[model samples]
Target: MHNHGAVGLPLGFTLLRLILLGAVTVVAGWALVRPFVPAASGLLTRRVVTGFAGIGGVVVLLIAEATWMPSLAAVALIGLLAVPPALRGARPVLGKLVVAAAVLVTAAAGAWFSGPPSSFAYITLMAAFVGVSWLALCPPTAMVRVVGAALGVTLLAGLGQVTIAGQLTTPATGDPLLTRVALGPSPVDVLVVPHMPGWNIVHTTDTPLSVGNAPNALVPALPRDGTTGRWALVWLPEGRGELWLDRAGTRTTVPVDPGKVAWTGPDVRGPEGPDYASAVLAAKLTGKRGDLPWPALTDADAEALRGQVAAIGGPFTVLTDDSRRAAEAAEVVREEAARRGYAVTPGTSEVLVLGGTPPSGARHHLAPWLVPPDLTTPEARRYARTLSAAFPGAAPSRSGLAAWAG
Candidate 1:
C-alpha cells in the first residue's frame, strides 16, 4: 500500500526540528517555573495557565503554518508556556477565552489577510504546541509523560494507524474530521493517443526548445553522448519490420524475424529477444539520424493570432477588471503581440477582461482562454463582436458582446 506523503523526512529538517524542540522545552521550563523556592502553588491557579497556553498555541501555530516556518511554530509552542504564567497573574479563564476567539477571527480573514497554509502543516504544528504546552504544565515528571505520549501519537499519525504485529489494532478508515491531505504529486500533463497501442512512454525536459521562422521548428536527431549502442524500432499498425542495433559509432541494420530479436551492448543479453510490443520505432544514430520537426503553430492559428495582435495595438482599449491578476494577463497579451510585430498599445476601443471570477463562478475550471466583462459601452461591444468574428466559438454574451480570457 502506497501511503501518501510517507516519504522519509530529510535529515537536515529532522536535525533542525530536534533543535527547535529542545529550545521549546528550555524556554517553556525557564519561563514557566524558575525552579526551587516558591514552587508552583495553587493547582487551580496553575490550571488557569493552561487556558492561556491554549490560546497562544492556536494563534502561533496558525501563523507558523501560514508562513511555512516549522521552527517558528516550535518557538510559538515555547512562547505559549510563558503566556500561561503571564495570564495567571490576572483572571486567566476569561482572558484566555477572549484571546482564543480573537485568534479564530484572525484566521478567518481570507487569503488576502490570513495567508492560508497547508492544512496538514497547521494541524501538525498545533498538535506539537498542545503537547509542549502540556509538558510545560504541572511537575517535572509531566515532561516525560507528555513528551512520550506526544511522540507516540505523532509516530502513529505518520504511519496512518496503530499497528500490532503488522496488522492494524484499530481499523483504518477515512475520517471526516481530518481535512488535511498529505503532500501530493507534482503537476504535469502529457498527451496519450488513444487506440495507438504498443510500448508507450513519454520523455520530456524543461529546457526551452529553440524555435525559428515558419510554423514549425526542426531539431536534428543527435544522440546525446553516452555509449551503450542505440536500437531502431520500425513498424506501423500493419506490422512489418525488424530491429537494428549499433555499437559505438558503427551502423548495423539486422532484419528482425517477426518477434525474434537479439541485442547486446549496454544490456547484456544473449542472442535475439522477442520484442512483441512495438507499433513504430526509430533509433538515434551517431551523426546519422533523422531531424525532428514540430509544428509551432498552424498557418490558420498564426494568422488568427496575428490579427488579434494587430487589433490590440490599434483601436483596443484594454480594461483589466482585476489590476492584480488581469493587469498582468493583459500585459502578456500586449508583449506577445509586440513580439510578433503586432505592437499593441492602449487605445479607445474598450476591452475588459473579468478575472478572479467568471459567469460559472469558478475562475479555474470553466472559464475560457479569455473572459470579457459584460459589454456595457459601445467600444466594449465592438471589441466583443470582433472577438466573436475571430473565434467562431466565442459567442456573444446576453448583451451580444463577445470577449475571451484564457
Candidate 2:
C-alpha cells in the first residue's frame, strides 16, 4: 500500500490519528455520562422512548452478524430502555444486581473472545472501547439517545472486518488480473490512458488513486459488434517455478517450471467470461524479463513518446488505466514494439511478460510505471517520487469497503 500524500504526510500516521481520536471521544463521553447515573435504581427505570428503541435494537441485532458481546450488550440496553417504568421500579434490587453483573461479565467475555483481526486490531479495539463507553452512557430516560449511537458505532467494527475480507474478491475496474497488470496510487504506478479527440480529466480531486480503478484508463470503445478485441496473452514462466492462473475450460494445467512464454492464444471475449482467456495470457515470473530495462520517465513525455511510437503504425491503444492520456502515448510503445518485431494486431492488446532482475548488461531501466513488480531499483523510486509530485492525489481512506464486481 502507498503511504504519504502530495504534501508528504505519512498516510499510516494519519490513520493512527483517526483511531486515537475515536478512542478519546468515547472515553470522554463515557466519563461525562457515568456520573449522572446516581444509583443502581436508575438502571431499573424506563422512559417513554424505550419501546421503539428496543424494537429497533432487537431487529438490528437479529439481522447483524455482530459477535456475541456487542450483540448481547445492545440487546440488554434495548430491553432496559423498553420495560414499563413502574414494572422496572418494582423489580427486586437483587434481580437488577444480577443483570448488571451479567452485563459486566458480557463485557469481559467480549474483551477476551471477540477481538479484531491483527491486521486491523487498533481500529477494531477502538470500536469495542466505544461500545463500552456507550454501556456507561445509556441513562434510563435517554436510552434511545445513548444506545442508538453506541450500537451504530460498534456496528461499524463488523463492517470493517467485512471490508477486509472483501479485498481478495473485489475486481478492479480494469480487471488487471485478466490483463496481467499492476496498480498503485501514484502517477509512477498509474498507466496513462491515451487521450482521444474529446478527452477530459475525469477525477479532478486528489483521492489517492488506484490505477486499476482510476477513471483514466485506456478503455477502448466497444465495437458495434460488441465482441472483445483479439488479445494476445503471453507469459514466460520463471525458471523452474510455475503458477496457474486458470483451472477451468481448456486451461486446467499448472506449470511447475515453465521454460518459455506460454501463449493462451488469441482471445476474443469481453471481461465477462471466465479466466480461460486470462490464464493463457498469464505468466509466472520469479525474477525479471528482457535484457535491458527502459528508463523510468517523469512528467509527460508526450512529444518524445510520439516520435518513438511513429515506427509502430496506426490505430493502437495504450495498456493503461488513465482515461485521459493513455491513448496519446500508446503510439510510442506500439510503434517501437512493432519495429522490434513483436506482434502488433488491431483491436488486440499486445502483452509481454517480463520478470526477474535485469542482468549486469542492462543499461537503461524502464520507467517505474512500466516495470513489473519483481524489478524495482533506486532509480525507479526516484522516478516514482517525481511522478507523484506531478500528479498528486489525496491520502486513501480504506476504513470501510465492500466486495464483488467483475
Candidate 3:
C-alpha cells in the first residue's frame, strides 16, 4: 500500500523542478512552431501560431498553475519559432524590411527592460525577426535551412538567458547569512551568525531577522565560534542582543508587552531563517568545524567542569534548593570517597560537619553545611541535617559551610 503520510516534496526538489520547467518552456517553443509553419498559409499560419500561443498563455494563466507564466511564455515562443520557415518563399525584400523593423523595435523595448543576457520578450522578438529576415532576404542561399538553424540557436540562447533571468528575479531561498556589521570606534565589529543549511525545510516563517532590517540586530547576532552545528539567527533584540538556535522546529515570537520592550533600528527586520539555514547546511557539507560550542547550556566544555568536581572530593560544597537533587548526588559522591578513605566534610544548613583531615599530601575534602544566603535559619538547618545524615562521619554546621568558601 502507498503510504500517504510519507509522501512529500522537498523544498529543494520543488525549486529545482520549477527552474527546469521554466527552461523547458523556452526550449520547446521553437520546436512546436517549426513543424506547422512549412505547410500553412502565411497569414493563416502567423495567426494560427500566434493565436495558439496566446491561447496557451491564457490557459496557463487561467489555470494559475505553479509554472503558469513560464508555460505561457513557452507557448508564445512557438509562434516566433515558425517565422523562418513561413517566410522562406514570401516577398523576400518586404519580409526582410518587416523583419528588420520588428527586430529594431524589439531591441529598443529590450533596452528599456534591461533584460539579463538580453530581455526575454525582446530576445524572443529579435530571434523571430532574425529568422524571418534571413529566410526572406536570402531565398537562393539555402534560406529555409539557414534561418531554421538560426531559429534553433536563437531559441536555445534565449531559453538559457531567460532561465537565468528567472533565477535572478526569483527570491533566493539559499544565500549566505549576511554578517551584521556594528560600527566600533576602532574598526567594525562584525558578528558571525550561524546559518543552518537545511533549516529552510522546516522553519519557513520569515521574521524581521530574516530580512536584515530587524531593529534589534543583536537578537539575531550570537557569538558563533563554530563548534556546534551552525545556528540560525532567529530573533534580534536591539540593545538586548540576539537569540540564535539551530533551525529544525517551529518558533513563536515571545510577545512581550509593547511598553516592556522597545523596537529601534534602521528598519523593521524580517525573519532570516531560510538564509541562515542554507549557510549552516553548506558549511556542514564542507566539513567545516567551528571553535565555540553553541547556546552555552549544552556545551561540550561543561564536561570538563565535571572533572574539577571529581578532584575536589568531599570538602567541595553543594548548595541546593528543596529539590535536593544536587544534595543527593553530592551525598553519593561523598559516600564513594569515604569508602576510598578520603576525609571530607558533607554539610547542609541544619548541621556543620567535619570529617577527619585528609591523608598526607591529599587534596582538601571538606563538606560545609551551606544554603543560599536568603534561606530561613530553620530551613537552612533542615538541609544541613539531610546532608549530615547522609554523611554519618562528618559534623554538619550552617556557619562552617559559609566560612569554608574563600
Candidate with best lDDT: 3
lDDT of each: 0.31, 0.30, 0.33
Local accuracy of candidate 2 as per-residue lDDT tens digits, 140-219: 34543355345445545544543343211222111112212112231111111110111111121232222211122222
The whole-model C-alpha lDDT of candidate 2 against the native structure comes to 0.30
Could you give candidate 1's per-residue lDDT for residues 1-406 as a string of tens digits?
Answer: 1122212223433343444444344435433443332454355644543543455354534333344234443464455444655433323243443353344334433222322223343444344444434444434344444453553355334223211111111111110000111112321111111101122111111111211111122221121211111212222121112112222322212111111121111111111110110000111111111112211123443344445555445434343443333344556556655576553434433343323322322112211223224678776566556533332223343212211220
Ranking of all predicted structures according to lDDT, beginning with the best and ending with the worst: 3, 1, 2
Better of 1 and 2 by TM-score: 2
Candidate 2 stretches greater than 4 Å from native? 1-45, 48-64, 67-94, 103-111, 115-357, 365-368, 371-406
Q: What lDDT would candidate 1 get against the real structure? A: 0.31
Task: Give each model a TM-score.
Answer: 0.22, 0.28, 0.30
